[model samples]
Target: MTITTLNGVTLAYDDIAPPGGAQRTVLLLHGFASNRAEGWKRTGWYTAFERRGTRVIALDQRGHGESVKSHDPADYGRQNLAADALALLDHLGVGRCDVFGYSMGTRTAMQLALDAPDRVSNLVLGGVGGKLFDPPRPGAAEAMAQAMGTDDPETIENDFLKSFRHFADEQGEDRKALAASSAAVSPPLDRAALGRLPMPVLVVAGARDDLAGDPAELAAVFPYGKGKSLPGCDHFSAIPHGALKAAVLDFLDGIPDEDDFPPFE
Candidate 1:
């Protein structure tokens, strides 16, 4: 539950270590509107990774959870979001770490790897797409802003409930904030930009995801990226899907021996 103050924001994150194991840390960035607890711990991912001997650091991105909120739409831009992540790493005194992001967080994590390639050792991106774009829904921006502006228990819980069962649900208050975050400005990445990455990358998606394009099409964007689509699952539920999770862990373990970076201490 410790909070780190960095770049004018209080990043609430959970740093979890194994029973008595490695220092290598995997930074977990949750999707939009959702907080760190729901994205990682509540979903059973935190325990899964910890059991694997990899320390996990799950972050509540700015404007969500206990983090600072910026009224300026531009400040919520993807670049700034990515910068916030790097700043958190610096604040933690972590030289390098593995990263795993889902949906909105996947985009942010990808931008971080691109912005600071040397600082990233490995990446596992789930519920991802080839390009960064706003989800298909009306009044998306307004819904997201409302979520950021308030921390009402009922409102927040409602938002999470709405997003459940879909890989990329884009409705309700939290969904609206996510849509707003994506719609506020230009996308952080362009087509073909993902393929140029020299690092090992894993691209994941659900077979039933409506928000993102085809999994094969999305995976085609990354040279080293491999796609795994989970059948009978949608955007939100895909993360918890057995097939999806295994695909991610397998990809992370498949990184070339020499290029692998140690987890954070």
Candidate 2:
């Protein structure tokens, strides 16, 4: 674990190199309330990338993991979160690299690619899809915020929100910080901006992931984008699925045919 102060907040990250040094680099951004360990290492992502001889860098986003936590909603804006990633890259002296993001991290990855195109070579977005362009469901964010803020778990009526609250509690995260982040402002998705990205993009989601909508629709927005749906997986289950890792490895390696990949059991 490495500690760095960026934008007045301390951030925690891991930088692991392959046995014989790395031929390429990949940056990983985790999901909401998930740290690098829970999101990537524990999921076998670090080893997968290392086996490919790629340098792996994964960060715990602000208000999550070992990074400094803040209860101020103003501190959790989308742009600010993306900026922290950019600062980390600059601090590490990495010029360009591939990026993989899951769930909330996908939004940050998109912002980075849009704001710093030259720095990101390719992008892999998991657990997110066409819903990126949709306006926030009415009160969805508020419900999640409430769920995180409440002391009594039974009060959270929404199953989805309740699940998040339970996960936060299990992780022993700062609920107030999470609540602020949930309520933070997010940038409006711009299809025109996404279409302009020249680098290849991959979107992956579970077939049963209602939160992500259709992955193919989101992929169509990018000129060089492709989408893959995991069988019998939902948003959370899709994260650690072997098929998801295989798809990402194939995409990053520039494999032309996804059809040859075996179906997930």
Candidate 3:
């Protein structure tokens, strides 16, 4: 575990070097309220990437894991988070590499690619799509915030929010910090940036992911993007699916055969 102070916030990250003769390097951005260890390590994503001969760098986003916590919404934003990712890459002397971001991390990864396409060789987005900018699911964010702030469990009051609350409790996270994290970085994105992006992009979503919006709509916006759906999975369930791994690994290897792609909607 290494820490870097970015504009007064301490961000924790891990860098794993591939054994002898690495093929490529990948930067991982985990989903909201989820840290690197839980999102990538415990989930077997870290080992999977390494097995593909790629060095891995995973970071605990500010307000999560060992990174600094902030109760102020002003402390977070899409561009700000994207800048943090770039600064980390700069700190590590990483010029070009592949980037994989899931759920909330997907927003940061897309911004990173748009902000500095030269720094990224390939971009992989999971568990997100065209609905990225849609406002939080009614009271979902509030439910999450409430969950993090309370130990009483009954205070969360919303059944859908239980998992998030449970997850925060299990991770021993700061409620206010995560609450702000969920509310911040949430202004609509610069949609124009997608068409202007220079690298090939891959958007993967679960077939049953209502929260992810339309993956096909997202891919259509990118000049060089493709969307794929994993059958029989929802947003969370989509992560560990073998089909998801196969699809992503295939994309990382090279452009997929046209047949594997979703028609632009």
Candidate 4:
């Protein structure tokens, strides 16, 4: 574990390379309520990447892992999260690289790619789908915030919110910090901006993931985007599924360096 201060927030991250050295790098952004270890390392991602001579850089986005926790809703905006990731890359002296994100991580990755396209080569989004384009459901954030803040779990009637609460408890997360982040409002995704991205993108999600909606519809919005559906998987199960890793590795293996192709017209 390494520590760096970006935007006045202390961030925790890991930088792992193969024995001989890394031929490439991939930044991993995990889902909300999950840290780098639980989301990537334990999921066999680190080992998989190491075998391929790819360096792995993963961060516990503020408030989730060993990183500094902030109970300020004003501090957890999606752009702010994305900025931290961008700053981490700059701090590491890494140039362009591939990016993979899951659920909330996908939001941050998309923001980073939009804000600094040249810094990202290939993009992989998992555990999310067409819901990416939808407006925030009214009161959903508030409900989640309430669920996290409440002392009694029984009060969380919504199964989705309850699941979040249960997961947070299991992870031993700071409920106050989670409450703040859950209540924060992120800027809506801009379809026009996404359509303009030139890098290859893969959107993968479980076919039963209602929270993500249809992966194909979301992929259609990108210039060079494709979608993959995992059978018998849902939002949670999809994260650790071997198929998810296989799909990501396959997609990444097929992409050449930026210099190998002409600018998209």
For every model in order, what is the number of clashing pairs? 13, 0, 0, 0
Model 1 whole-model lDDT (C-alpha atoms) = 0.70
Per-residue error for 224 in candidate 3, Å, reads: 0.7
Q: Best TM-score goes to which candidate?
A: 2
Which lDDT tens digits does candidate 4 get at residues 1-265? 8987877789999999899999999999999888899999988999999999999999999889888899999899999999999999999999899999999999999999999999999999999998877877888888888999999998888998899899989889899999898888777889999999999999999999999988878988999988888888899998888988888898899944333469899
In model 3, residue pairs whose N, Cα or C atoms come closer than 3 Å (at least 3 residues apart or on different chains), thus clashing, are none
Structural similarity to truth (TM-score) of each candidate:
0.78, 0.96, 0.91, 0.94
Model 2, 67: alpha-carbon shift in Å? Answer: 0.7
Cα-based lDDT for every prediction? 0.70, 0.91, 0.84, 0.91
Deviation from native of the Cα of residue 246 in model 4, angstroms: 0.7
The number of clashing residue pairs in model 1 is: 13
For model 3, the local distance difference test gives: 0.84
Residue runs of model 2 more than 4 Å from their true location after superposition: 259-265
Q: What is the lDDT of residue 207 in candidate 4?
A: 91
lDDT of 2 by residue, 1-265 (tens): 9998986789999999999999999999999988899999999999999999999989999999999899988899888888999999888899999999999999999999999999999999999888888877898888888899888999888898888888888888899999999999876967899999989999999999989988889999999999888888899899889989888999899886556468889
Residue clash pairs of candidate 2:
none
Candidate 4's TM-score reads 0.94
> What digit string (tens of lDDT, one per residue) describes model 3 on residues 1-265?
8988965578999999878867899999998878999888888888898898998999998788998888987787878888888989988889999999999899899889988999989889999877876666677766666676776876666665677777777888777888898777455777887788988889999999888977778888888888888889888788878877888888999846567769999
